[model samples]
Target: MLIRRAKQEDYCVFAAIEADCPGYPSWGANGFAAEETNRNSVTLAAEFEGAVAGFVNFWILRPQVQLNSLAVRGDMRRRGTAAALLGKTLEYARKNACTAVDLEVSELNSPAIAFYLKQGFEVVGKRPKFYNNTETALLMRKTL
Candidate 1:
């Protein structure tokens, strides 16, 4: 898989991937278009055989990078595409001088929580009823 910064033209593919991935927060095309223009945002794509297989969106805040969203095509899960996208995002954050990476995962998404833990993220806190009114969110962080 090839990982690289996403271009504005790739938003359609990015939006499609997010739509297909389970546990993704819903966002419209215009939302992604707006994100593409943010100076502090770093959106990345994982390409396989010339197609986008996954993507990660992050924001560079002072001293830290906030992992806004990470999604892999449903057909592409379990193939390390998400991991590659995440690794590239972390690399980008480090290059941009971020000292840490942070994200919130839905409490019900055990697989994703495990993936984050295996990638060196630790649970830092929790947000009560953070998703859809009933599901809580686990706040995870990793120091780069």
Candidate 2:
């Protein structure tokens, strides 16, 4: 898989991927397009076999990096696409002199929580009813 900066054409594909993830929050093509104007935001795409397999978006805020979104094509899961995308995010973070990475994951997403843990993140806090005012969110962080 090849991880690189996201392109305008990738937004539609990303939106499609987000749509496929039923319970996951989606930014849609419009949202992704808006990020193009945010100087601090970095959007990346994981390409496999010339197709977009996954994507990750984050903000480099000097001492910290906020992981905004991450998703992999359903058929690409368990094949390291997510990991590769995350690895690239970390590379960008380190290059930008970020000391830590932080993100919020739905408490109901046990698989994602486990994946973050395996990626060396630790639970730092929680927000009750953080998602859709129904599901709670677990704040996780990884110090670089």
Candidate 3:
């Protein structure tokens, strides 16, 4: 997969990928468009076979990178799309002098929890009912 900076055209497909993952928070095309106005935000896309298979968005905050969102096409799961996106995000963090990566995942998302753990992240804290004020959010972080 080719992981690269996200383009305006990629938002539609990225939104679809987000939709495929039911229960995952989704920031539709408009939301992504809003990100373009944020100088510190970095959005990336994972392309496979000429199609957007996944995407990740994060904010670079000097010593830390806050992972804001990530999703993979339903048909493209387990194909390294998410991992590639994340790997590239880490590279960006490193290049920008970031010392760590941080994110919050829904507590009920076991797959994501495992994925984060596999990527060397540890549970750092929690926010009760942070998701839709119904699901807890597990704060995870990985030191670079």
Best by lDDT: 2
Residues 47-87 of candidate 1: C-alpha lDDT, one tens digit per residue: 99998888888899968999988888888889999889888
Q: Tens digit of lDDT per residue, candidate 2, span 1-144?
A: 999999999999999999999799999999999999999999999999999998999999989999999999999999888899899999999999999999999999988998999999999999999999999999999999
TM-score of 2: 0.98
lDDT to native, each model: 0.86, 0.95, 0.93
- Quote the lDDT for 133 in model 2: 91
lDDT of 1 at 116: 96
Candidate 1 backbone overlaps, count: 0
Clashes of 3: 0
Model 1 scores worst on lDDT over the 10 consecutive residues at 21-30
Record all residue pairs in model 1 with backbone atoms less than 3 Å apart, i.e. clashing. Answer: none
Q: Relative to the unseen true structure, what is the C-alpha lDDT of residue 11 in candidate 1, on a scale of 0 to 100?
A: 85
Clashing pairs in 2: none
Better of 1 and 3 by TM-score: 3
Model 3 lDDT tens row, 39-99: 9999999889898888999999989999999888888888778889999999999999999
